[model samples]
Target: MVFEKDPTSLYQIYPTTVAVIGARYGDELNFMAAAWHTLLSFNPPIFGVSISPKRYTHDLLMKSGEFTASFLGHGHAELVEKLGRTSGSKINKVLEYGLELLEPRVVKVPGIGNAVAVYECRVLESRSYGDHTFFVGRIVGLHYDPRAFDEVGRPAYDPVLYLGKDVYVKIDRSRTIEFDPEKFRK
Candidate 1:
């Protein structure tokens, strides 16, 4: 077909799993919808989220040195977009939405009680890259809703994957395949 040359912020690597980051400074709690995040390390369970320094959640993150990553489901897309559209400094979004929160097991911050998966992390390192800052946190605690996994403990892939620009899709577990890794070995 045809080819085009463009080097813009085209978010080509989207359809990414969405998560709502939760942070608390003392008694004040905040949450933000994030599509850019990843598991930085498996051994230490380090997780990282890129945040613009201007965001109110970024301030809470630095002040508390702790945060929670809550995996969102398809049902939460509207709530996710609402949080992304406004600044937490303007209103208490948690109370505004009547979002349920969980008592964190290891950190002072809170986790979304209705989350399919949750990770409570304590900051290990933070570095700036352009307008955004990457904060690496060591996972201190983790949990997943029992219903999200199969009997053998394989996770049912039903996460809300953000396609960018306010679009999202939930992965279907029925399309799953249990591949044999050794069969493809070189």
Candidate 2:
């Protein structure tokens, strides 16, 4: 068997739709569109999301110690670009976009509605690295749209992919070949 412990280089990281929302203790609440997010653990249901040091949500997340990651679908492509291009500090993201907000069960931060799946998370650890800070969270609750599940019980989300530098694309499964280890890779 060709295997090694901690083979981090084997995986190719691609951009995904991530909506990060947090409330600032004294300042206004902020929601940022992020593409840098990953699941760090599963047993405790932990995740890590990165925010720029200068972002409004960054400070809010640090102060509140809670955040929500909302996975958007193809319909939310425009909203994603809008949130990423503009600053939450200047414009009210949720208000301007008419996004639905749901109160978290365990955390003070609100959740986004357009997301097909939402994860309410409480900050477990945080660290500053270079221009951005990574906040690791312990997932508190999970929600998904029942309609999105197929007959096989797999959650199917609409195409939502980012193409770097103000460009976004939707993934069409019909046009691409999905992973099949038996057919291609051994």
Candidate 3:
């Protein structure tokens, strides 16, 4: 198997906005928006989210060792940017944005209700990689709006996707296509 240099440009990957909710170390609570989140496993339900040490939310997650991943819903593009740009050490991002919070059953950190889905997670492991730390969490509790669930029980909420440098997108679920490696690689 061969691969080219790191060509995973911003245009190459579909983006999703995630609200990282956790308790601050000393006091207070914090929830920051993140774009670097992905599912790592399904059996134990684990997710991988990368956070920079400079981010105030990072310190909180590190201290509590638990957090929530809340998916952003429509009309939330501006809120995501606002939370990502501001520092919780100086300002209360949740209160500033008028975001509603819900107490999770397993964690002290609250989950954002604005999102279609919220995964209440406990940190299973953390590893520092380069300029950021990646946290692997196991999902302990999950919540979502029933209206956002489709007839098939899948989430129907259209997630707001982040494009590098400041662009937002929503999933075009109607445009899915089946792929065949042999047909396209030749």
Candidate 4:
């Protein structure tokens, strides 16, 4: 039997890779792990990250007009959790976590050096939706660890997937399969 409940319990989309959103404005820098991010477009390479106004990274992103989204492997789940739980206003997450910063080729903001992939983006627009502000950015530069992906661009490394409520998981590659969509078309 199917069960339904209030919309507030809508965290069904759990196994999503966490993207570490990094922002820098002048001398200030901060990083936050966000599961609420996605690739919005392919033509212009637009990406969106949702952040609450209360977050310090949100303020830096507004001032800088640029940011970096870094996707790390499953091995960094602990680091991701730490970054997401702590407030950047009260602590220097990068310095406290001992994360290495990587220089961006097109934006002022840097990315986590150990990231599997990083996208340097310039803010295209920002809109408030409920409690969070959705920032859309046009990707200007991309960095990736070639070994972490297959030739066709499929992830070869185990990505850190958030299971909500401070839980994390990784893909079981042993169960992975490749299929042709046309085979299912009747």
Candidate 5:
């Protein structure tokens, strides 16, 4: 195997869940599919979504100070792709796609009705990192489909995983393995 110092094409982490970031400012609402998002902290329940400055959602996020990270199942891959490719600035994606939005509990932004899990967050901070701005948010509310998650919070349903370059995949639960670190104790 060979490796390069430049990390331009290093998208090794391909199977990450696609996070549909929803933001609203007044009557304007937008949802963008983001492959670059993760849980920042557990103590204060913080989440972060890396969005480019040119995205319409970025402007709404800054003005609203709140957003929702909605995780959809594998069945919605087509919808996710549509959301990622289109720009909210040019058209109303929600109306065009006929997306059903759920009423938010804590934040002003609503989540996709079909989402398996949605995290309603209030903006904590935003900082520039390269071409994207990392928006850190404190989780204010959580909505999850109980049927989609196991008792220990493991995903029971196939989740939409982005593989970059317009590709998508899902988990095969039949191949899942449970590993215990205690067995490897020195």
Candidate 6:
């Protein structure tokens, strides 16, 4: 059975992994959970995150012009939930959450030490769209936890996905597919 509704109902296909956006403004540092992020390029390693103007990170980026995108393993769901609920404008999330941060190799912003993977980025440009703004950043460096990968250099961590309304889920790796499009092409 199939049906249609307002475009806003498109959230039905969600349960996506949210990226923890990390940035620093002078001595200030903050982290927020964001589900609207994507890789825009590979060669130069461009990445983008949709941020609401009301978010504190937006102002941090506007001044610092740099940030880090981090993906935490499913084990850190508590941290993710806490980040999403708190406002950086009110308190320091890193200290409030007791999150251990790693020193950035290429940028001033520090990434979550618990993140399975992290991308350090420099803002290339940003544009307004409705109530949210899209920040496009060029990745300058990346780091990852080796435990997150397997013998074949493939991700082994159970993916952490946010299902909105405070729900969270993890991908069952047992059903994971190793598909090869070129070999199966008809």
> What lDDT would each prediction earn against the true structure?
0.87, 0.75, 0.78, 0.93, 0.93, 0.89
Can you write out model 6's per-residue Cα lDDT over 61-122, one digit (the tens) per residue?
Answer: 88999999999888898898899889899998977888898789999999999888999999
* TM-scores of the models, in the order given: 0.90, 0.81, 0.82, 0.94, 0.94, 0.90
Which lDDT value does model 5 have at 138? 99
The list of candidate 2 runs beyond 4 A from truth reads 1-15, 24-27, 151-154, 176-186
Off by over 4 Å in 1: 1-8, 151-153, 172-178
lDDT of 2 at 54: 89
Alpha-carbon lDDT of model 3: 0.78
- Model 5 misplaced stretches (Cα beyond 4 Å): 1-8
lDDT of 6: 0.89
Candidate 2 lDDT, 10-95, residue by residue in tens: 33455555554555455476677887888899898998988888888887887788888877787777877787877877998778
Q: Candidate 1 versus the native: TM-score? A: 0.90
lDDT of 5 at 95: 98
lDDT of 1 at 25: 94
Superposed on all Cα atoms, model 3 deviates from the true structure by an RMSD in Å of 4.8
Per-residue error for 6 in candidate 4, Å, reads 7.4
* Candidate 3 lDDT by residue in tens digits, 56-81: 88888888898888877757888777
TM-score of 4: 0.94
Candidate 1, residues 1-186, lDDT tens digits: the string is 122343236578788887799989987889998887999999979999999999899999989899999986788888888878888999998899998998899998888888988999999988999778999999999988898878987666567778888888877657868789899999
Q: Looking at model 1, how many pairs of residues clash?
A: 0
| Model 2: ten consecutive residues of lowest lDDT | 1-10
1-186: candidate 5 lDDT, tens digit per residue: 333655436789787999999999999999999999999999889999899999999999989899999999999999999999999999999999999998999998999999999999999999999889999999999999999988998998889988888989877768979889899888
Per-candidate Cα RMSD to the true structure, in Å, reads 3.2, 6.5, 4.8, 2.7, 2.4, 3.0
Ranking 1 against 4 by TM-score, winner = 4
User: Is 1 or 2 the stronger prediction by TM-score?
Assistant: 1
